[model samples]
Target chain A: MKDLTTENITENVHAINSQCQNPRTRYIFERLVSHLHDFARETRLSTDEWMTGLDFLTDVGTISTDLRREMILLSDTLGLSALVDSIDHPRTGKSTEGTVLGPFHTHDAKEVENGYAIHKDPDGTPLLVLCTVKDTEGNPLGGVQIDVWEGDSHGNYDVQYPERDGPDGRGILFSEQDGTFWFKAVKPVSYPIPMDGPVFNMLQMLGRHPNRPGHVHFLLRKDSFDPLITALYPRGDPYESSDPVFGVKESLIVDLSEVTDPEMAKKYDVKEGTSLLTYDFVLVSTRETLKLRKEKAEEAIKKMGRSMEDFQGLPILDVD
Target chain B: MKDLTTENITENVHAINSQCQNPRTRYIFERLVSHLHDFARETRLSTDEWMTGLDFLTDVGTISTDLRREMILLSDTLGLSALVDSIDHPRTGKSTEGTVLGPFHTHDAKEVENGYAIHKDPDGTPLLVLCTVKDTEGNPLGGVQIDVWEGDSHGNYDVQYPERDGPDGRGILFSEQDGTFWFKAVKPVSYPIPMDGPVFNMLQMLGRHPNRPGHVHFLLRKDSFDPLITALYPRGDPYESSDPVFGVKESLIVDLSEVTDPEMAKKYDVKEGTSLLTYDFVLVSTRETLKLRKEKAEEAIKKMGRSMEDFQGLPILDVD
Candidate 1:
C-alpha cells in the first residue's frame, strides 16, 4: 500500500511534467513535480487541504484578465519574480540591473520628442528627467530606444484611469547622438497595489501592508545589446524599505535629489526654476537570441492547450 | 538578503497554516512550505513557469462551484484523496474501511422501502444490491442510516441530467434492528470523468484516460459511531485497474455473482432470473469530529484577491 501511494504520486507528477514540450517548460514541470511530491510526503498533506489549495489557485486564474495580472502579481508579491529575475540575469559587472516590469506597462506609448512632457495633468511641480545610456567603458550608445512610464501623484497609472487614452503618462524617446536622453514627466509618487483582490485579502489576513515605493518604469533596448527591463525607485520613500513586490534593488534605487540650479534646468528645456533629477543607465550587449525566448513562450502556450489568439490583447502584466 | 528570502517563505507558510485553525492544517502548511522551498531551490523555477502554475490553479477555482467540486475532483484524480482517507481511517479492525465519497452524492436521497427498485429506467440488466452493516465482532448496528447512490446503465448520475431531480437514482434506507441492510439499485457501468476543464486537459496532455469503474456510493452512520463514507465497485471491470481517482480498495471490491434462480429472484422482488450483487459494509465506532472540512480555502481566496460570491451553483465535490 505504501509503495502504491508513492508510485501513484510519482506517476501523476511524471504525467504532468511530460505535458511540457519546451526545454524550459519541461525543466520547470519536472521541478514542480519533485517539489509537489516532496511536499505531499513531508507534510502528509490531507486531501481536504490540497483541494483547498487547488480552489485558491483557481480563484487566482479567475481574477486575472487583460487588465489585471493576478497570477503574475501573486508571483511578484511572493518573491518568485525576483528569484527568477536574479537567476536569469546574473549581475556580473556594470550591466544594468533587471527588476520586475510590473503590471502597468502598455505597448501603445506615443513617441514623444526629446524633452517633451508626458504627464497630462501635471500638478504644477515642474520637474525634468535626464537619462544617459552608456556601455561598460562609458561610451554613449546613441539612438537607443527608451520607454518610460510612471504613476501620478495620486499613485495611479494612466491605464488605471477609466477616462484616459494614448499613453497619458507614458512616452518613448530615442537617445541623442551623445547617448543622452531627456524627457519631462511628473515625479512618480508612491502607490499601493489594488487591495480588492485575493492578494489584498491575503495581506490583511497576514497583517502585511501593500505599498510599493515611488518608481518609474523603463524598458531600454539597443542593437547588439541586451534588452533591459527595469524600474527606478526613489531612494527615500517610507515604503521603499518594504516594497510589496520585492522589486527594489540597491543598484536601481536613484536619489531624486532636489536641484535648484536654474541653468541646469534650462539645459534640459525645463522652466528656468524647475527642479531636475538625473540618472544614467548602463546596458550589456545581447548574447542570447530573442527568437529563442519567443519560441519558448509559444511552446508553453501550446503545452497549455491554448492558442495565441485566445490571449490576444489580454493583459500580460498581471503575470509580470 | 538571502536570509530574508528564506524567512519570507517561512513566514508565509506559517501564515497560511495559521489560517487553517486546525492541527491538521498547521501540519500540512508546514510540510507544504518545506516542499515548496525545496522545489524552488531544486529546479530554480522561473518566474514565467511559476506564474503559469498559478494560472492553472486559478482556473481550477473558477471552474469549481457548489455542484461541480472541481477542486475535490482534482484531489481525487491526483490520488491525494485516497491518501488522506487511508491516513484518517488506518484500517482499524473494528471500523468500516473508508473510500473517497466522490462528487455525485447529494443531500437527502429519496427514502425507498425495502426491496424496492432504485433504478427508474430498467432497460438495462437488473441486479439486486444486498448489504449488511456489522461491527468488528459481527454484531449488527440497528437503526443505521444507509444512504446509497449510483450511476445509470449509461454511466451517468442523476445529477448529471439537467432535467432530473429528487434523487432519481438515489435511495436512503434504515438498517433493520438486526444490523442488516438490503436494497436494489441498477448494475452500475464504468464511466469517464468530465472531459473538459484543466483537469481533463491535463489528463489528455499526460496521455492518461479518465475512466472509473462502476461503483455505488454509500454513507453509513449510527449514533456514537464513526460515520463511514465509502464506495463499493464491481470486482471485475477493465478500468478497475486504473480507476482515475484511485478510489478502489481491496476491501471495497465485491463480486456480482450471477444468479439464475427464479425463486431466489422472486423472493428479492426482482424479476425472475435477475442477477444479484451481495456485499457487506463493516463500520467502526469512533468520536472523531466530522464537521465539513473547508481546508485552506479562505487563505487561497484571499491570496488571489478574488471574491467567491461570483461563483455560486458550481459543484464542488468533497471526497473524504
Candidate 2:
C-alpha cells in the first residue's frame, strides 16, 4: 500500500468511498471529499483549529431539539442554505423565487380562513397581508394554500416560548375565488437568531450581527403547481442589508405601506394606520419545473463526465 | 445588498465576514467558505441532500460523549486527521515520521520501568516491545518517556468496556542509561472502529470496511525534543492497505519475528517463541521543528496573498 501523504490522501479517500451503490450519493460525496481536502490543504489547517470546529459542531447538535434545529441555523448563517435553495429553485420565467424554509417552520399551524386573524394577541403594529396567486401566464389560481409565519414584536417565535399553548403570528389560509388572499397579522420585526447557540458564537467571531431582517415566511401550494417556500422581507428594515442567513433576495423584498385610511382599516378589520404588506406570487407548473430541473441535472451529470443512465433511479426533483 | 446567487454567494459570504478582528481566523474562514460554496455548486446539492447531510452530522454529534468522540471518528474516516498530522509533522532528516495522535490516547496511563509487563491479564500472544530513543544525529538519548497502548486479542481497549477497570495493555516507560527500553504486552489485533455510531453507518453507505490494521500506539517525549505521536503497524496485517483512518506509513510498518530461543525468552521474562518487535525512534529538537513549521506557515500565508505580520498573534505551532 502506498503511504498516505498530503498529496495522495484526497484521492485515497475518494477511492475508498467510490463503491457507493447509488450513483447520486457517490457523486455528491466525491465532490464533498475533494473540496474538504482542498480546504484543509489550502488553509494548512492546524489540529487545534480542527478541534475547535468539532467542539462548535457538537455544541450546535447538543442544543438542537425537535422544536429548534440548530444545524439548519448553522447552514443558514453560512450562506449554504441560500445557495442550495437558489440552485434547486432557480426562477422560472416570471415565477416567484424561493428561499430557505428556516428552522422555525412548524407543521402544526392552525388552518384559518381568508381575512382571519392569525396572531393570538396584539403584540405589535396591526398589519394586513394581501397576496394574489397566479400562474406563469398571469392567470388567477384559486384554492391555493398559503402558510404564513413570523416572529412576534419581541422577536420570538411561538416555539421559542415554552408556554406556547397554540400557534401565534402563524397560520394556514387558502386563496379566495378571485385568487386573492388577505389576512390580519402582526408585522414581523427584525430579531436576532437564538444567541445561546453555537451559530451565534460563530457570528460573533466573524464580527457579524446575529439578526435576520424583518420578514414574513410563506409556503404556498396548489394542485399541478410547484410549491414555493419563501419569505417577504419588509423594505428598509435595519437588518435588511446584513441578514445573517442570506435569505433575502431582491425579488422577495416588498414594501410595507402604512394605510391611514379608516375605511381601509375597517375593511381589513385592523386599527387605522396599520402596516400593509401586499405581493403577487407566481408559481410554475410541476411539468415545467420538473423539465427544467431534469435538464439542469443532466447538465451537471455531463459536467462530471457521467451518463444519465447511471442516475436514472435518483430523484432529480422532489416535485412529483 | 446584492442578492445571493450560486455565482456570487461565495464572495458575498466572505464580504459579510470580512470584519473579523483576528487575521488568522479571517484567513481560515475565507478559504473555508470559498471551498464550501464551490463544493455545493459543483454538486448542485439538492435541499433534500443538504438536509440528509445535516441529519448525519447531528447523529454524529449526538452519539459523542466525553469518552467517545464521533466527530474525530468522522474526521479520521475522511482522511482529514491523517492529512493534518502529515502536514504538521513532516519528517526532518532521519527523524521518525509522525501520524495521528488518535482519540485513544489517555493521560492516566501508569508509569513503569524498562522490561516491565504492562498487560494486566494474559489474553493474547506474548510479545516483547523493544525500542531505543535517539537524536536525529544517531546519538542515544536516555530518560526519554514513551507512552504505549494497544488493543487486546479481543480487539478491544480498556476504555471500550464499561465494566470497572484500571489501565490494561497500556503503560508509560522510560529509556534506560543505554537508551534501550523493553516491555511485555499482548499482541495487538486488527479491529474495526466503533461500529455503533453514525460513522459506521457512513462507512456502510460508502461500501467500505471499518477495520484498522493491527498496530500499537506510541507517544514519545523528552525535554527539548519535539514530541512524536505515531503507531507501528505489524507487517502483513490484512487491513494494512486499507486502514480506514489512513494512519499507516511505510516506515512505521514493521515485522514481528518469533523468538524461539529459550534463553532469549527467559531474558525477556516471556514464554518461549514469543513475538519480538524492535525499532529505534529518532526525535528532532523542538527548535528545529518550530523552525520548519514556521517556514511552512509563512509559505502558506504568502500563497494566500497574505503577510505573516498579520497573523503574528496566532500560535503557528503548539510547540515552543
Candidate 3:
C-alpha cells in the first residue's frame, strides 16, 4: 500500500537489499536513494522542474564523446567530483594532497626528459615550471614518474581540438634523482566550460558562471607512495577565488614570478622572458606495508567475484 | 581556494545562482547540488562506485529511444518518480488518488462508447469493467473523457511491441449522463520491467524484483475540474504489497467481484466466464474559479517566455 508518498518513497526504494552481494554497492545506493528523495521533498520540486532535470541529464549523455565527458563535467560543475575525491583521499595533512582526475587524463602521452616543453601548440606565453618530488620527511623521492597535462593559454585541452592526433600541452616527465623536475608550458588562463549543451544551459539559467580557473594536472607515482594526483592553479585569476569546479586549494596555488635573468633562462633551457612556477610535491608515508595493501585490495577484489585480469590497471596499490 | 574539500563543495556549487533568470529553477538546482555532494561524502563513495553510477546513467541514455525512456524507469526504480508525483498531486482525501503516469501513456487512443471493450489482442480471460465518474460530493460528472489503458494478460503494453500501431488494451471512453462507463479488457497480470538494460542490471544486483503489479492506467479530463491521472491495481497480487515503483495507493486498489448471475451477463453483453471490475473516479473541486486558473497558467507560461501556441495541450488549466 505504498501510495507514492514522499515519506514512503525513500523507505520503499531502499528495501532493495534482499540480494545485493556487494555490501558496498548496496550501501552506496541506499544512501543515494535516501538523499535523492530527501532533496526532492525538501525543495517541493515541481513536475516541470523534475522533467527539466531529466532532460538535462539526457542532454549530458547526448553531448558526451571520446574527447568530452559530459558526466564528468556535470560532476565537476556540481562539486560532486571534488567531494568524492576528498572523501577517498582524505586530508591527512601528511602527504601531497590529491585532486580530481578530470576527464582529460589519458594514457601513453609522449614521455619527455626533465625540463622539456609540453606546450606543443604554443597558444600562450612561455613559462618554465620547476617542481620537486619528495617523501613526507622532506627526503627526495627520485626517479618518480610524473604525468602532467593542462589547458593551453586559451584555456583549451589538446583533446578539445577536433584535429588532434597525439597529446599536446601534455606530457609524462621522469623526475631527476634529486627529486627535482622542471618543464615548459604556457601560462594558465581561466576559461568557460562547454556551454552549448544542456548542462551549460541549466547553468546559464541558474545564474552561475561556467568558468574553471587554469591549472596543471599532475599524476605522480613511485613504488611506495599512493598515486598522488594533484593540480596547481595560477595564483591570481578571478576564477581562482571562485573556481566553477571548486578545484582550487590554497596550498596547491603557485605564484608565477617573472624572471628576466638570461643566465637563469639558459640554466633552465627556456626563453629569458619566461615566467617561473616552482612547486614541490610531498608524498605521504605508505603506512600499511606495500604487501599488506596489495593483499587487502586483491582480497577485496576476489571477494567481489571479479577476476584480477579483468580489473587490470584499476589502481590496485602497486608495491613495485 | 577550494581544493576539492568537502566543506566548500556545496557552497561553491550553490553559487550558480548569479545568472539564473528563473528564480524557481535556481532554487531547485541549488538544493540539488547540495544534496548530491552531501550524499557522496556521507557514503564515502569510492571512485569506482561513482564511475559505476556514471556508467549506469550513460547506459540509461544509450538504451533510451523514441519508444523507451530508461531515464524515467531509472527514476521509477529509485522511487523518484513516485516521490515527485506525490509532491505535485498531494492526497487531499477528497478526489480519486493519482499514481505514477508510467512511461506507457500515449496519444490518439481509439475512442469508444460506454461498455466498449479495450482489449484488442487478448491473451487471457476476458473481463468487463464498469466505471463511474463523479465529483467529490458524489454528483455525476457526465460527458467527461476517460482514457483507460492497461497491460494485457502478459503484462505488456502495446507501446512495448514494435509491430503494434495505435493502442490495444487501451481506449478513450466518455461518461454517460449517469457518469458511468464500462469497457472490456483482459485481466491484468503482474509483469517484470524490461531487464535488458543497466537499470534492471542494477536491480538484479541489488536482489530486487523489477515487477510492477497488475494495474490499469486512466487519464480523465473535463473543462471545470483539474485533469486527473490515476492507476488501479488489482487486489491480491503479491506485488500489490510491494510495487517496485511504490505506486500502489490504498484508495486506488479494487478487487474484482465474481459475477455468477447469467441474466446480468447477457444484459451487460458480457460472457458468463467474465469477471467484473467496478470502480468510481471522484474528481476534485476546481477550488480556484476556472477563469482564474486559466489566466494564471497562461500568465505563468508567457512569463517563462514560451509562446502559448507552442505550449498548447501543455496543461493550460483551462476553465471553459
Candidate 4:
C-alpha cells in the first residue's frame, strides 16, 4: 500500500510555510501540517469526513463577532485554553494558581476608589467582598491594583447589556495602605453560555449542554510580582463539576456566607441580611524580564490592529 | 528533560475516547489528539503562540452565520476543502470529476423546463447558455436532470439576497428527448469573497487575495448513470491562477462567446450584444454500487438536518 499520508503532510507543510512571512507563523503552519497528517494516519480519515470538518470550521468563523467570541469558546471547549494556560504559567514553587482569563475582559474599565460599587443595576441582593493582597510569605502588598468584573444576578455581564457603557460592572481599584480592597456588588448568578452562535448549534449537534458556573473575574497586579488574571467560582454551584471552559480550580473557589451582624453592616453601610465574600489573594515575585516579555507580546497584538473585543466569548463544549 | 507532549496527548485521547459513544466520534477525537500532538512536536510550539492560534479559531467560530459559511471558507483557504474533494472523488476511471461543492449551494431549487429564465435580476448583461448531456460513448443521455445555480455580477448568489424565497437564480432543468438543455441568465462575473469575516481577515493578515473566478453550478442526475454535482468556470478569468477555493478544473471551463445573429438572439429572447455560452457535458458511468454509495453519503448529511442554504455565499474558485 502507498504511504500517501506522509507525502500529503509534507507537501502541505511546505506550502503553508512558504506562504508564511514570519518564523512564528511558519512554525505554527508546520506544526499544523504535521498534526493534520498524523490525524489522517491515525484515523484513516476519509476525504469526505475531512471536508465536513472543514465545513464545520468555516461555519465557526462566520458566526464569530465582537460580542460572541466563538474561537475562544472553541479553544476552551477543546480544553486547549486550560492546557495553554497551564503550560504558560508553569508552577514555580509559590506562584499563584493560574486559570483561563476567559474572553470577557474588556479594557477601558472605570478607575475607582478601594471601596467603590462596580454594579449600577439595582436588581440583585447586595454583597460585600473584602480582598487582600499578600506575598507568598503572607506579607501585605500595599498599593497593588486589582481589576474586577462579574455577571449580574441574571448571569448576564455588563458587556452583554446593550445600554451599558464601557465595560459594565468592570473597574480598576487600588489596594489601600493595609493592602486591603473592598467592593460592594451583586452576587453573580450562574448563566448559560451564548447559545445563538454556531458554538451552541455545534454543542446541540454533539449532544452537549451550555451552562457555566457562577464566577467573578479578577486581574491583580503589583510591583515585583507576576500579574494574575483569573476567576473565582462559587463553592458549590451545580455546573462547578463541568465548567464549559474547564476554568474551575479548587483554590480559586471563594465562600459567600450570609452575615446577620447589624453593627458590622452599619459600619460597612450594608443591611442586616447582606451576603459577604472574603478572600485574600497570594502572589509571587518574578523576574521583570517575564513581565516585559508578556507586555511585548500584548503590544505586538495591539500593534497588529487586533483588539480585546476580537478575542472575547464563551467556549464550545459538549454540555452533557 | 521532560517530554510532556506525548503524555498530555495520550491522557487527553484516553479521556475523550472513554467518554465518546461511537466509533466515528472516537476516531475523530483520536485523530484530533494525534494531530495536536504532531503539531506541537513539529514546531516545538510555545504555549502563548498556541493560545493565539486558539484565539484566531475562536473568532472564526463567532463570526459564522446561517447564510455566510465562514468555516467552509476557512477550510477552502486552508486547502482542506480541496483535499477532501480529491479523496471523496478519487479517480475511479469512469466517475465524474468531483470538486468542492462550496458553501453557496442552496437546497431544493424550483424545477423549470429547458430554456427557462433563471435570473431574476436584470442589471447584468444577458447570457444564453446551451448545454448537452452525453455518455462516455458520445451517445446523448436524454431525460437527465440538471440542477443549476450561479453567482451574480457582484459574486452574490440569490440565496444571499434577504428578500428572495427559497433558492434564487437556482433551478433544476431536465434534458429533452434530444439530450439538450438551455437556460437564460446573466453572465456571472468574478468577485471578491466576503471581506467582513475572519477568512478575509486571515487573508489580509497573510497578505493574500480573496478573489475567485466566475463560475456556474450544476448537479446532473439520471437513473441509469452516476449523478454529477459540479461547477464550471469561464475559460479566462484573471484570478483563475489563485482561486481561493481551488475548485477550478480545466475540463470544466466553458467558452462564453459574443453572438451577433439577430435570429439566434430572437430564439433566446435576448439582445444582439448578449453573450452565448455553449458547453457539452460528458459523464462517465461507473459501478452501480459506487453511485448508491455516494447517494447514501449525501443522504446521511441531509438526514442530519443539513440543507443547501447552509452553504450559501461561499467562494467558488476559477478552474484554470
Best by DockQ: 2
Best TM-score among the predictions, by candidate number: 2
Which lDDT tens digits does candidate 1 get at residues A1-320? 21234336556545534554444445445555566655554443454555567666666767776666777777676566665555434444576777877777778888888888888765736568888999877899999999998888788888777776557778999999999998877777788888778777655644567888988888898889867878887677888767777788777788776556777765776666565668888887655423333344454445545433212211111122
Off by over 4 Å in 3: A1-4, A107-112, A258-269, A286-320, B1-4, B15-21, B107-119, B164-167, B257-270, B288-320
Report RMSD (Å) for each prediction in the order shown. 9.4, 4.0, 8.4, 9.9
Candidate 2 clash figure, as a count: 0
In order of appearance, the predictions have TM-scores of 0.76, 0.91, 0.83, 0.69
Ranking by lDDT: 2, 3, 1, 4
| DockQ scores of all models, one per candidate | 0.21, 0.54, 0.36, 0.20
For each of the candidates, give the backbone clash count.
Answer: 32, 0, 7, 29
Cα deviation of B8, candidate 1, in Å? 8.9
| lDDT (Cα, 0-100) at B114 in candidate 2 | 81
What is the C-alpha lDDT profile of model 2 across B151-210, one tens digit per residue? 888898877888836787789999997889999877778999998889999999999999
- Could you list the chain B TM-scores for each candidate? 0.81, 0.90, 0.84, 0.78
lDDT of 1 by residue, B1-320 (tens): 21234225446435533544334444454555555655554444455556566667767767766556676777676666665665444445445568887777778577777776777877657778777888766887788888888888988887777787567778888988887777777788899887777888766755567888898888888887767888888887888767777787677788887557877776776776566777667776553322212223333333434323211211121212
CA lDDT, candidate 4, residue A237 = 88
- lDDT value, residue B310 of candidate 2: 24
lDDT of 3 by residue, A205-258 (tens): 666778888888999988877677789988778888777666778888888996
Number of clashes in model 4? 29
* Interface RMSD, model 3, angstroms: 6.9
Model 3, position A154: C-alpha lDDT score: 79
